[model samples]
Target chain A: MSKAERKAEVVDLKDRAAARQERLPVLKTYKLFIDGKFPRSESERYYALTSANGESIANVQLGSRKDFRNAVVAARKAFPGWAGRTAYNRGQILYRMAEMLEGRRAQFIEELETLGASRSEAETETAMAVDRLIYYAGWADKFQQVFSSVNPVASSHFNFSMLEPTGVAALLAPEDSGLLGLISVVAPAVAGGNSVVVLASHSKPLAAITFSEVLHTSDLPAGVINILTGTRKELLKHFASHMDVNALVYCGSDAEEIRTVQLEAAENLKRVVIEENSDWQSEERQSPYTILATQEVKTTWHPIGL
Target chain B: MPRNNAALAVTLPPQFVPIDEVGIDERVSRFSKRSIKKSSKVQALKLALSMLDLTTLSAHDTPERVRQLCHKAKNLLETMPELPHVGAVCVYGPLVKVAKEVLKGTKIHIAAVSTAFPSGMAPLKTKLIETRQFVADGADEIDMVISRGKFFEGDYDYVADEIAAVKEACGKAHLKVILETGELNTLDNVRRASDIAMHAGADFIKTSTGKVQPAATPQVTLVMLEAIRDFYYATGKKIGMKPAGGIATAKQALHYLVMLRETLGEAWLTPDLFRFGASKLANDILMQLVKEQTGAYQSIDYFSME
Candidate 1:
């Protein structure tokens, strides 16, 4: 064969290999995280997510009320077990979550950037999320000690107060910093020994779902932290009105939404804590009060000799 | 004894209508997919509430537990005084008297689980005495388990004769024959057992003893429902169906009702012709009904734990 013909054959083989590599990339399907498993919406509905430049990013699950109900059931099922664990074990698990997130730091940063955060903002948010988990982990074993009290009653009886987990918590993560916002809300509730069903930031949900992957592998029990990706406007009422939720944490300042939550939460008198328009990255956002928000105070009186 | 004509001679090589497993699965799937919405959902929940046989057949059943169950059966929810009483309170033979004293003057029937209960391994003479004693102790219904071992040994006639004898001992009490379809193994066997039970004078044919896995599944319920329909057509006797065990959700109870409505044409929708031998299912139905009334999901914590 001629040299020209051999060179042409080599070029053709390279072109074939390039074409094979250029086949459509396999995309990740963002699904609802319930009971530590990734499940698509039971309603079989999906919503398209887009970047700031109007470029389609991905199709994310549009969770239904039924999904919310199922998540609550799982959360309630996990509550007793999660709450019954020693605070030290829970703290260890939370620290393990931070370790998992740190191991996958690059992946989360890339995910946040793809969802439209700038590089610096994505890096800051990812770092804060890991630190926030560690912060709550430390509080898991100390909050009760700080909040519980030995009361001195006038009557001849021994009285004392102790903090207990407020059972299932329903949280609506802030719409701004998806990663840090979700971590801030979830860490406190779980560290206090309460299971949670959280609705992630509607626009930037990619990081929140990826964070669930961290929790899934970090020894966090299934259903202790269920994260769902969906629009807040659609799920706000269900999050507020579900009777099984003993506490609710909503991060926004919309008066109408707050009113709806307060009014509907009265159906079962769910303890609600609203953080309005606060910057999530501030040092003040990492307070132990966040953990106390979902803890119930139980006062016991013991009969004693006068 | 209200003996059926088919009981006169037990047919050897008994004729059982073969169940189309695929067809049954398809039909059951459709029933579950049905949209029972708005006012219809409320009505269905209420109907299901009335059809429940609140059962407590544990080996550790105490008189106090039976009494508590009877109270729950009579007054489902004190807060919701508008709800109807459960159809029956099902207990062990000895506990029937305890349940009867609590449910006396109420329309709720007391059903006793007899014939060695979950195992059904006792002698026929002992079973007869147990049934008669339960009836004399004010049990309005007797749920008897068929000898599954005899059925598996191909002794169809012994199974038939045993059921007839139990029915005679029942006297004025309604007789519900439990086939324990989970042990029967196949849909064909479930159908054959349903036919044998119906022909031997079962006022209601039940699916389980609540002690086995894979109990009262949609496929088994469907096969039994079809058998009941065919028997109605041939002998003009409308038999009842009770799919006990594992039917713990209101959605599942509604699906069974849908299957019953479609297969038997609404004639067997009444409590007299249908029953649910369930304990947890009552709370679920109450939760759904309360959710319908108040527009919020409910918690098991708020309901009685019978």
Candidate 2:
């Protein structure tokens, strides 16, 4: 080909590439995670949150009280089926979720970019979240073995001990972590056969709800995980005080709020897990022991027949 | 007893020659000859590695190989108690408070890289605000990089003023002006940057952001240290020095220390006078210390970097 003809061909290729770039899909708005499905917010009260550099990257719904009620209802419904599943079965399901999450990593990366994370930060956080899911998934079946035992009684009685999940849990994910914190807390609780209601990060909730969609598509039973995106103060106090919530896991830096939640959780004698403001990277991976922390050891003794 | 300033002058080897005496043409030709032969891929990796601050390693590195490295360097620092402490355990900014708490009552000051470190591309007001926030959070020192674009465009006055304003904003906290030597291009410009920052009231002159190619190198550090020495002679005040970026192994840190010892003498060897702004160096130093004290090499797997 002549030089001009070759140049013309290159320009055509460039145009095609530009067109492809322009056709990239924009992110969704106003999402909710409930009953293993990502549903649009009941009301369209969406608002945009800007990054430190003043770029509007994420759209969050001002989740209402009705949204919280629906989420709790869904989680409450999911509790029986999920909690009744055998530990081995739950472990397999969680591992499958991790596999699915790993496959869609680029989607999460784009979501993270929309949430204003630097390229490195977005990749690391997403990878860590997936790794965390796998880490906790491996713990599902092992927790009972690690935390329970068959007891030797003084009398001729059969005694065995086993750890049981705390029914339903409520969590406030960390603001800075976006999807990572949301998934980290939710995955561990669900992997242990407990249902959860999580309040997504206020500023960056898109990724959390998108992750919820992932969970929805996974083989996970409905109502096992419910996510709401809103202000922490508005949702957290209610979750903390909810008598139905058997435990509360709060990922936040504010000392005073943590203290108040710890105190309020006492009302139901609820189990409270607090992750102090820290590099999540430094946190020990969740294991069977982690499940034991939120579970109760149940022991039963049977009298020997004469 | 009066301190002798002459003792602080760095000694050169008999064969060592000044760059000026060697001539710019010769230096450029020599640099090109050495640089061009390397594969672009290898150079990219070297450049990428050079850009990493490695601060996160200080918090989470636990491989036995890594621990051994830390142990070695820690021991050396302990033995040379007279040497200045390494710069703050430069962790993620949130860890600034943790470092402060950990290093409490110790003479070792806490330093945090703020103002969107590695690149001061953020707004000046935002940078100042961040500096103030870090200081408020108990950081004793702040290290910030100059606007590379401004410096490259011969806008030295703007760069100098920015450093001065940051110095003023620092209040009681010390400010370390990072020259980002790899991007500075010429020794003359590097020298000029040192003078500008010193005149602008920088408490110390730092070498790199650990986020730029060719960050902190012996050659670059040697040039900056000489500039600091010269500035000290011209002005009565002595400025501190920090060579950050890609300093992982104990040997590299020791080499830098040796450079400091030979150039600035024992006076500049203290934590107050000098610091190795690194994440991995501390652990490597600690590992060496452990080996020295225990008389056995311990598996590094047991210890978390934090």
- TM-score of chain A for each candidate? 0.95, 0.86
CAPRI-style docking class of model 2 based on DockQ: incorrect
Candidate 1 per-residue lDDT over residues A12-84, each given as its tens digit: 9999999999999888999999998999999899999998789888899999989999999999999999999
Error of 1 at B143 (Å): 0.9
Query: How far does residue A114 in candidate 1 sit from its true spot (Å)?
Result: 3.1
Error in Å for residue A82 of model 2: 0.7
TM-score to true structure, per model: 0.94, 0.45
On lDDT, the candidate that comes out on top is 1
Q: After superposition, how far is residue B201 of candidate 1 from its true place, in Å?
A: 2.0
Tens digit of per-residue lDDT, candidate 1, span B1-306: 333555445432246678889988888889988999989988998999899999888999999999999888878888889988889989999988788788778999999999898899999999999889989999999999999998999888889989988998999999999999989999999999999998888999999999998888989998989899988988898999999999899999999999999999878999999999898999999998888888789988899898
lDDT of each: 0.91, 0.70
Best by TM-score: 1
| Candidate 1 CAPRI classification by DockQ | high
Instruction: Determine which window of 10 residues in candidate 2 chain A has minimal summed lDDT.
Output: A281-290
TM-score between model 1 and native: 0.94
Candidate 2: RMSD to truth = 22.6
* Model 1: colliding residue pairs: none
